[model samples]
Target: MNSTYANGTVHRYEEIKFVPPSNNHKTEVQSKDVTILPNKNVSARLYLSKISRKNKKFPLFFYIHGGGFCIESTFSSGYDSYLHKLTAQANVLVVSINYRLAPVHPIPAYYDDSWDVMNWDARGKEPWLKQHANFSRVFLAGDSAGANIANNIMVRASEESHFVLSLVGMALLDPYFGNGKPDVLWTYLCPKTNGIDDPRFNLAAHPKILSKLKCSKIFVFTAGKDNLRDRTWTYYETMKKIGWKGELGIKETEGEGHVFHM
Candidate 1:
């Protein structure tokens, strides 16, 4: 790989540890890994309350994790613990996606992997999803860079009619977006892009796409101490200003760092 793209290559894999699927009795949440794309070695960690009967269906929470789009996984320990509690308490089935990282696969690879996973599950190929998930109440969520991916996916879903899943809501936690300025990280991931002015990084630039989000509701969360906090507020304000026909909400955790809720 080029030296410029070799940023955080070693530290990322060393500091973050992967957590295997677990069947924790305390939370009553059981998780297992299922392959979504065998050819790419891509997979997702499925989390659901084991106590919840198969006859009953729960909202599907499609999640993506964050590590600057270069690190982290659906199996990361932090995400695993957080999702376990979320699945148990919220009574929602979680599909945490593990997308290919950058510097090797680069920009569109991770985005494409996430979209492919959604399409794969919508076909009813997984028994857990088919039997226990309520497809009509699906929600897409992510934190930091994953939030960026979630936003892009939502925009694409709105444009395409064949995405079988019903995405009723989306939640973004400290989403990584730019304020109409050049962003070094985004450019590093997508080398050929038009800097941060690209709609993928700056959603506020494209009012039409923001107005067309397929989901009817959106929740944005930011940490007061996070450097990206202001950008999130800008996104919320832009969404409201566009007269997008969606119920929107935002919250900021006082004195917290990025993604502190997780």
Candidate 2:
């Protein structure tokens, strides 16, 4: 893949692609985009509706999109479509971010962007978040690499005083953690990490991190045939073993692959 190149040689591939924001006004969900990182031009799409503004007490859904820290974005067609529907059906405002990719931005870049955006929301710096979103019921959700980002974010949120988050729940769909040998792409993207052992890549590798999740519950979904199934299931079991106080939920489909719900 072009993203694997670390040499100075430029690879112009992986151009940013996006599907336009939803335009159907029949549904209550209204969408808008705003920059979270001005220097990098990184942005997040916010889905808020008139109903969400009724009392400014609607649940907040903060979403992270999966691309193995290499590709894809919040605005990608598949992701955008999903968010649009989710916002309406769930009757919540969703903030889906576009973080920096790897082999170009490197490890921690993705995490940093999410962290910054979360803090911005925590401080009520974002107009839409402070105006219409309910912080007390904020839920984090993601698929694959996005789930990894959400998990990492939750861990950091628990220990950091800077981020005043009211995280109520986390939904990780087919998270990208590994059980054994790390995927070559994982190493390629996060070259600074210690392959699969890094807590960021495999949470099971560090059970102590489980206690740091600052949420009431975590929902993990894994498909039977997904290569990462064992690792995710193990994480759920290990969390229970550790007496993680939060309610844990796990779901699996017999013949599905990673993130079949998407």
Candidate 3:
């Protein structure tokens, strides 16, 4: 499939095979193994790369990889490619997290770990942060289930005025929610449990939190064929109705399905 960007540049989707990170070697980007002490110790990892040192303060982009809250990790090449692209394009410090997964950790556990990492990063103020990671210009970007976690963090950050006071933008890649749709279809289609009413996956349940978020820019990318397409649009409309003064970029990828961004 092909899509034309605002710059009039045409881009085509090609099949790209990824090799998972091996124990023996590391990619060009150096990742540090760290455990977030959130209430209980949360097992997590951070991928770090310094883009530039000329600027005293650089923007930080926290990324959450998507896999239906069950199967993907920050080490996956699909996520690695996304991080590399962001590092080259934005000149910001990108950290991809491996939060605890579902069916084992369940709902709120993922949200908890995400918030924990955000808080951990907030307290540490990494050295690169002084030279490259901008504490005031942070952005949250994620895909699929990761997008759900990112949105939750944004809500929590706004509510508690925690670590994300500097959040200026958010990019949700195909967020999944029910939006009052028939549960039967969602249950039949999705491999995981289709508990659309679950606070983690349901956006309407957190209207107050969503309203409190002060993001100036929001980008939601969804494929026309995705079941979650309507939910993404609904959330965008909800943000507008709640008087969020932000620019929303809703791009519908033609002839693509869910997880197309990955």
Off by over 4 Å in 1: 1-13
- Model 3 lowest lDDT segment of ten: 21-30
Displacement of the residue 173 alpha carbon in candidate 1, Å: 0.3
C-alpha-based local distance difference test score of model 2: 0.83
Q: Write the residue-wise lDDT of candidate 1 on 1-262 in tens digits.
A: 2333345443344466788999998877889999888988799999987654547888999999998888778888889999999988888999999998777788889889999999998887688888888999999999999999999999999899888889999999999998987677888788798777888889998888898897999999999899999999999999999998889999999999999987
lDDT of 3 by residue, 4-46 (tens): 4678564545443544532213334544555566545564444
Residue pairs with backbone overlap in model 2 = none
lDDT of 1: 0.89
State, as a TM-score between 0 and 1, how close model 2 is to the true structure: 0.92
- Candidates ranked, most accurate by TM-score first: 1, 2, 3
Error of 3 at 59 (Å): 0.7
Candidate 3 steric clashes: 2
TM per model? Answer: 0.94, 0.92, 0.77
For candidate 3, the C-alpha RMSD (Å) to the true structure equals 9.9
